[model samples]
Target: MGRQGLMAGYEDLVKKILRIRPELSEEDLERKVEEKLRSSPMLSRLGALLLLADELGALEVSDGSALPFDLSGFTKVSSLVSGLNDVSLSVRVIAVSPLVRLDGRAVLRMKVGDETGKASAVAWEQKAEELATVGLSPGMVITLLHAYTRSGPDGRPEIHLGKNSSVEVVEDTGTLPGVESFFVPISKVSTAGTFDVKGTLLMLSEPMPIQTKSGTVNVVEALLADEDGEAVLVAWRDKVDLLTGTLPGTELMLTDVRFRGGRFQTTVRTCVAKVARERHELSRLMAGSKRLVSDKLLRVLDVVKQPELVTLVVSDGVWVYRLPSRSMVGVEVKEGDAVRLVKGFVSERDGRKAIMTPEFGIKVVTGEDARKAPSVDRRRRLADISEEESDIIVEGVLQTKTPLGAVETRFGKAEKISFWLRDGEATVLCSAWRSKAREIDSMPVGKRVQLRWVRVRRNVFGELEVLVEKDTKVVVLEK
Candidate 1:
């Protein structure tokens, strides 16, 4: 590489650095790079920029590469660099375009993604026919080997496959994330790109058939809205299935969709699935300034008895909610009871969102009226537990463990207990706070117990652990 080649590489490195540290202006980045090269006279400009990127924490694996899936020898879509050869990436097929003659050769274009980001890829000649033969569809995970990267028309890096390249279906991994997991909040979308979104269907238009070169295509338009904002979603061909039979207020998740010309459009690779509306709208209970009118039935998941305040871990079928109060609002509430919070003030405790009610805000619903409340299941398998979920119930045989005792926390020194809960499928570490530590201390070794309303969160070492607090209901069951 000559001076021009070296300068191009330097420019690319500068762009990569700017992408991660957008707060730094281009002139500032160039100035810093110049200063680094001057200090280390022997170091090349690119090497100096790499060191600078490391110093700024821009080159860390903190991006989507931190996902649980196997990323060995695979590059994240967001990390793709133009002018790199023999790149390997594991991504889910987002869309596949029909075979077309490009520059007198058959070409097949696709959109692929992992949890981190999405990218555009093109297959040429033999590879194009091979991909079409394989009938690649949306959601299929595959790895591209010996592919090359080039900047797209929009200046973003894209993958290209030639004669030496190969694509293999990833069959061994079950942890590959679905496209829906990357849903972008409605208010955050501001540019043209492929994105996933979860929102309630506010409006829908009748599908109309349009004649095209290939065949007749059905088109439908829908208005989607979430807590933050709303957007227009347009669907074409089979993607129109999302709009058919869908009613207003029904929550929908659109995956691998494209946003352009101030609207959203669904491609062949787009997947439309109806999301759980009850959970989607639960945020409204805690958000907004207006007082809630309709009584929201909350199923008591766990009850913690304290000296002054009783902490009730509850759920509205989807999201686990916290309620800490000195008074039960003239109602007798227990674990598994269905109650309503009237004019409750949503508050946050130790980073956890909770609701505080006054006078008569807490009311218990029973018998015939309870049937109308959302059904809440406190039972869950250890394997189903994830860091993103909370307020879980698990039944398993406990492994013997003594109380850790007197761990220092922000609050103060608190008694702590640890044990292993093992079911047929998996085993998980269960730890308890001071209020619940005594209960676990008395339990015999290998005893079967059901722990309800236990919180699921990561420990200090970044491992998922079951947290038992005063509200946790631990029932010793017969072995």
Candidate 2:
């Protein structure tokens, strides 16, 4: 065959082989070529060029650039150069795995020093895996072989190491260069909203459960006062289990605090708590301060085992009702059973205040002696006067009702149901969401039922609507 025809035939074979196994690396393709050449010695040069093309893969090559080495050298050297990089300069030593996912493919990352400054060099996936095995430790010098530049994720140029690239690690016996370390003072570390602040533990509270996205979360919230005043630190879940019953004044450290409701709170998932004896430098910076109000004292109302909903009359003559769920479980307290709740912030529903339970220390003082508060008279009558003002109790028959099963909520899953009910006064439309919904749905619609903890809200059409939540309970009455 003529030279052009021979070359064309060899290219066709290379394309066919690549199509069969696109994932084949340079060494893999060369192995196949060696086997073919052994069978037909006359086709050795054509096999060599095809092997080189397979190794190069899709990477672009400069014009007139010769192949780095023969097939044997390409395979052996490619294995040796597990990772490769060619950058203007080297910078700080940052771990590379987090930067990219190579799936066992050779990868490399290096900071190369340049005339202007230092920059990062990144090799992705298969190319990265190949370079990784060559021991590209920090401060190691390497020579770039058949390395080329390509655009990276951030739209900037980065090194792309192919089979032709070369890398090496050499020992440096001279005095090591000083590495710069960064530090932030506690005061300067601004936690604008909720954030995690790690410092010496200045004070701690008893272990308690706080409602969170993951259901009931056991937690111990304490004051982590450093040189920059004090911050609320919460140890969640297992951390709470470990820190509970710890000494009050013992030093503690916390991580992964979340700032919410104008205070820092941590959950079982993101928080870590520990007790220590020595004060940290941040704590020293926090010295010489007057006694600030303790978080325990501020959050006292959270721990009180009250019903899911509690009503308090504020000094402004507005009644504020605090509702409990998986969210407001643990808090510290301070004052009165009937103290007025000051309006701080209102929740999504215009009526409830967003004040921390511990902030008011208020208690249920009026109904202390009554074992059974006349729910039918107080709650039901209010429901009758204005459906929007109702907090009703009912004993009625639930007719054939459509059940609303589990509903997805930001907090978690909740079940709901809609039912028609006949009380002495009138037939009403009622709906239950969450646990209560499941309970009501389980009862026979024709059976007599008693419902407690029901709240009435006006729908968009100005009709009274009963909104039943998880805390609402349904009892099947004896006919």
Candidate 3:
């Protein structure tokens, strides 16, 4: 080929790799292809270039005859690299993850690898159910005929099986080789894959309830560390129940854990977790751990989110206890719960108290009970709040709608609105998020508007002011 032809062919190969792994940096692509070319024999330099091009998808498969009969159009996982990104290839099933229901369809995603590299494969609808019918399991050699390829959101190479694809168990006839299994360190885990690793439990967060499309699920996080590094372990649903009795500093071997994007996590079902037999080292390490005194329980008066972290303002109503990151524990508690510092680190910055560790405990109590604790006085009439007091609750009727205004936000700007509220005694300006500003539209002017967990403080100019927090419940009572 001439110089121009060679340049065109090389550019086409680069474009092919970009199609499947678009996130692959240009420098990475150049290095991989150049290395592959160098490993080839010098006598087939020109031939190697042609093969690379055709393998990547530069040349379309010939129509009808002339091509190899039966297996003429098959491709390999390694060549699925570079050209046309998508290729019809056969691979062995390394591990099949448990079927998860999504939108009423049983979706099966699994780890499939070849001699080249590891990749993920997914099947949905009828293809998913056929996985069991074909008796697909760990170390099963399966031929995914007419399967296409795509780049996962995380840039990992993935094989996709659609309605056009078919899966059949192939005998170990030396043609298809089984992929080697290995353990991935916690540091190298970030995307979706089935992996195994062992580490010592450094920290354990309580089960946090989260709402999902399937329903509510409890998520608990455990930090595992060894001499190498630390990895995060998350257990979902009933899986968290398994770790409830497991204490910090225990040794755990997480096998076949489903690690999705964000952090190292583990799901139940197909995953197998084995804890260490003894924990003498763990017991000695926690000997000096700190514990919260029940007498110092701080009543949570309100909740506020500063950026991505939720700050719980706890008090006996006379003093404020600031717990900076209650979200880390994933605990759902509001004004009714009494937050107590537990077995974790605690510190005081300036004049305020701060719970440094994500670990803490909560005690549920009514507003009446909170008021009875020592000097706490949480509820008062709209006109009764004094300038010296803050973090109180009030109930009134929304009198007028405040004009919505825009405020600077992390992404860009956000809207906010305020209104006047009355309780037959006095009035205060109640604010709502711009997205929630229209909530008062359905609220009749005379319809009673009850505000719980509102903040009353003196603004910059030294005037008594009332502020509504994001968690502040604004319920419109009927006439």
Candidate 4:
């Protein structure tokens, strides 16, 4: 703007040119400065000086990004700045965000963190294109050699990788200090950065078609979780397909998903998801060993025994589960017996919510035999315990029998017999103790039997109860 300001800018440029080409003598410098000033007509004196020096080949530029990042004598990210010496850094590739392009230049963004601190890394042009060829991913450890730092717009430290600089894959990083993740646990998820999440599909609500500003989108609500915590995931339009294909207790991973509007969810834009074909950790949950209690567990309020399907009711909800073979599940269930449906699919029929499961994914806990027994329904015979009466009076047909011989007992080592019986409605297990084992030398299956005043108790493994003591009347009602 003023003659004095113009002179100051030009003087600064002359000094920079001299620093790069110190061989230039005083006379040569004076002549170069005069020629540059006369040939360029930029308002800023420094602008004209730089323009002339560049065109006249008087300025020397470093071949940046031409050397591999060298870790030799490297330093920490928190220790470098814009004008500081270039140094190498070791960081975890927390996330690789979407690439940005402007004016024909490409820049790839990466959220990198290390034991000491976290920073953003930018790769320009060619370096950005080769990012995929380098096979980088989140949770991976990387080493950036000969890298430099600069203050970002927000005035925070940022890493800049040039042509010569490189990010080499090292190993997967351990838990980073003071660092969060794109694939953080459900409990730790927040509305902050672009991220991913992995969890089991606990429950999926019916897809509700809503009219949005974008268009009509089929929005499906889902509950997701791992061993740690849970979050509600909502999928719109194309992502709605995930609901039908997924099952309860399914292991899955969602990519490019986010947390917004107080919800942990994402649509299928650049986002993707992968699901385990078969149920994983389903047994642990059904057996009550590994419980994700809050929403993962379904408390059975009642059970209905169908020919090949079992309908379970919980509170105000109901599930119609198809059984491949009720044989494996011991179809006999009662009210209050907790049922963990691993791969149940929720659907709607006649405006009512219905659920189904694959034959192999079914597991049940019977109220009568469970270690944690609920009130059994005695009004209905053993076959139907939806009433939850554990009154212990059961008259059923003898289904099978096997002698578990020579079990040590209070009356010395005596014979033990295990048998299954069904009261035309449900099946149960019974054991004949020591002397009572003699009453029926060998139980004739297919015969109707009755036991009076038998003591019922849950066994060690929370399975069948052993009855038929010396005082108990073991009568063969029909053979």
Which candidate achieves the best lDDT against the true structure? 1
Candidate 4 segments exceeding 4 Å error: 1-88, 95-110, 119-124, 145-165, 171-184, 188-222, 235-262, 266-479
Clashing pairs in 1: 304-470
Q: Alpha-carbon error at 255 in model 2, in Å? A: 4.1
lDDT of model 1 at position 211? 44
The Cα RMSD in angstroms, rounded to one decimal, for candidate 1 relative to the true structure is: 23.2
Residues 1-479 of candidate 4 have per-residue lDDT tens digits of: 23354366556656666666788755687776576545532112343455555664545464332111223334665666675435577777765644557588877767677666566678788877777445466666666755667887557777888776656554232644422443456656765554556667766655544544465666666666566555667677666664566667775555556676545666332233344534547544334422222222455544545343345543323332211223333566665666555554443322233343434444664454333423332223655433221223467888888855778666567787878878765787778866677665566778887765454556787764746644455668885
Which candidate, 1 or 4, has the higher TM-score?
Answer: 1
Give the per-residue lDDT digits (tens) of candidate 2, residues 241-322: 5455665345443333455533455542232333345545534634543432222111111122533323221222233233
lDDT of 4 at 316: 20
Q: Report the lDDT tens digits of candidate 3 across residue range 1-479.
A: 23354356456555554554567776876665566556632212333444544555444543332311224345656666422333555566655655667779877777665665556677878888767454466565555655667776556556777776666554344555543343455656666676665666756665555544476777766666654555557778766765677766666655557665444566543333334535666654344334222345567666665344566767654665655564433557775576555533333422334443344444445566555644355667888866645346688877887566788877567677767888786987666664466565556677786776667767676766667654566766766
lDDT of 1 by residue, 128-152 (tens): 9877776676667777877999997
lDDT of 4 at 392: 35
Deviation of model 3 at 12, angstroms: 41
Instruction: Note the clash tally of each candidate.
Output: 1, 36, 2, 13
Best first by lDDT, ranked: 1, 3, 4, 2
TM-score to native of every candidate shown: 0.37, 0.36, 0.42, 0.34
- Models sorted by TM-score, best on top: 3, 1, 2, 4
lDDT of each: 0.70, 0.45, 0.58, 0.55
- Model 4 TM-score relative to the real fold: 0.34
Alpha-carbon error at 321 in model 4, in Å?
A: 21
